[model samples]
Target: MGAVRETLDAVRLVDHHCHGTVAADLGRDAFESLLTEGEAWPGISPFDSPAGVAVRRHCAPLLDLPRHTPAEEYLARRSELGRREVQRRFLRAAGTDVFCVDTGYAPDPLTTPREIAEAAGGTSYEVVRLEGVAESVQTAGVEPDAYADTFRTAALEAVRRPGVVAVKSVAAYRTGFDLDPARPSEVEVTEAARRWFARGGRLDDPVLVRHLLWTAVDLGLPLQLHTGFGDSDIRLHRADPARLTDWLHLTAGTIPVLLLHCWPYQRQAAYLAAVFERVYLDVGLTLHHVGPARAGGVLAEALEITPFRKLLYSSDAYGVAEFFHLGALAFRQGLAELLQGRVDADELSLPDALRIARWTGRDNALRVYRLEADGPEDD
Candidate 1:
């Protein structure tokens, strides 16, 4: 195969699945510095749903509750200042127009039934939503089966607000992943899954996966599922892409499934993508954990194996803004470098780049969330 050279627009790129909420918590200055340092950083954002917001509110306290007094539990809590700060930083660094938010996992905050995301004219921050695979059951104490109803209602209510674009779902963890092998099992493994299942989870049952997929179709939403190695508590093999066969079989003909971070099983995930019409994949954990040195190879593999249109970008950006922004930049540039100079690089040609850039980012999101055409405009 001949090497293919592709040019790119000045905009850099879009990161489909970043947790800007955590980055936003890092404060504005740190966020700005990180973006300024990383030239390739395209966009930064998060799900920022009610569960996300609650996570923002309670993370510190949750961590400190054990050491601190119960009464002072609320004192360690911080704010979502990082969300606004990330916006400010993105505007300053990339000038990109959108930052897709993950709203499916969160219920509508009590203060507002749905606060549609809005972008300021010429401002870098525009809140976009990816609905589905909500955390309502885990966060709001709702039943597992009711996830569909709660998610559909919340999505309808939120999408009506404009900036809402798509629905994103997750099935990777009841607890968090332990990336560092040194500190393992600090988090209870099956217990978290049990907690999640107690509310409304059925990871072992193929029927549950089908039910979730049907719920996506019923709501006419695109689903983004977490598939790859995750926190220590999660069974690594359970996160395999093969287990999603039932889901793939059910939705292959209709609803779009944006597979999020099929890391250890990247090849398997890409194979699945090739076979499924509606199956697309994004690079989240790969970018965050793989780093720039290896990201190029990973991107090349994804581009070579999956159709360009089926490929998407994401930061899976987490922690503080600076760290997240750097991770995002590493991914965008890594992809460009891997696909730009090679003649056989059909995967990263300028056209494919644009498709992955513009269409894959929010357009795919729109199609998945059923927010296309008649959905509300930006808030």
Candidate 2:
């Protein structure tokens, strides 16, 4: 058990799914808004939440404050440090070796992929977003007949970007997973594209969204899909990964499907990972939101039936550098405790526990994205 704990502490993580941090300083209002999955109401501070407390206890020290510093003082210290140094400190503290960043959603100014890589002293790779490409095609005025082909071509080009390791979709935010599993015919896609262009807003039409996913499959890169838990945009019940069963069946053996942030549905995700050879999952955003205290419980549920090889580590950190620090802290602490307990109980051998810790924290992601070759074993 002691050996297991020591190994996880030293294992450099590969954050397989995350977003870039901001490039500029944030006022209290802007900063608080990024802290939660919902809007900050008139009176309540995001500082009162689990994530907030975690930051104060875990991340405050990195900014040169005592643990559990008051929120007001914490914010003041952050503003005093300025932006670049803040990012550098937090990214370095995370001790991550590689970052697979999703460059899709940036409501605020964010560090670019290269900037993030530089700040952390690690490699950074891109995960292209599927819907952003389709929306761009619409904004660029493609003819209805050309929409399907144009989107497919654009997506193909997007993945060819030098650092792109994979592609992602926020269909969970748009239409949910009850979508029909079958691919739309060319005619259906053309008509759906025509309606979408006329409606002229987000690309939410069910048919077109499915087309985007299938296009992801055709591109043959590993595809990441937002699963349970997100901002107000997600319809909680509809976002369940179980609803994706048929779609998974239809696309089986086509490409790897990585489920992101499956909380509350971590069990469902674990079930899927048990059955689907190409399916993988991570409880990323969920960890930061639950904070360090509950990270072990959440991780235990995610690993209950999940194959060790099918689980990967992610921060899903966006906008806030505190999350980069907190997420890594929570993962290392929680995963270490859980695996060490198994070793103590004699449920797993010392060697097996160490292997699982290494796989979940780093090696699994490296293999999933094919960043580099790893030995073939599921220890």
User: Per-candidate RMSD vs. true structure?
Assistant: 12.6, 3.4
Worst 10 residues of 1 by lDDT: 107-116
Task: Give the number of the best model, judged by TM-score.
Answer: 2
For model 2, the superposed segments whose C-alpha errors exceed 4 Å read 373-379
Q: For residue 25, what is the lDDT in candidate 1?
A: 44
lDDT of 1 at 246: 63
In candidate 2, where is summed lDDT lowest over 10 consecutive residues?
370-379
Q: What is the C-alpha lDDT of each candidate?
A: 0.47, 0.90
User: Looking at model 2, how many pairs of residues clash?
Assistant: 0
* Model 1: CA > 4 A from native: 1-6, 22-87, 104-161, 174-210, 344-379
Model 2, 134: alpha-carbon shift in Å? 0.1
Query: For residues 1-379, what per-residue lDDT tens digits would candidate 2 score against the true structure?
Result: 3787789889989999989888789888888988998999999999899998888888899989999999889989999999889999999999887888899987777888778778888888889999999999999998999999899888989888888889999999999998998999999999998899889999899999999989899999999999999988889899999999999999988899999999889999999999999999999999999998999999999999999999999999999888888889889888988988998898999899999999999999898899842212110
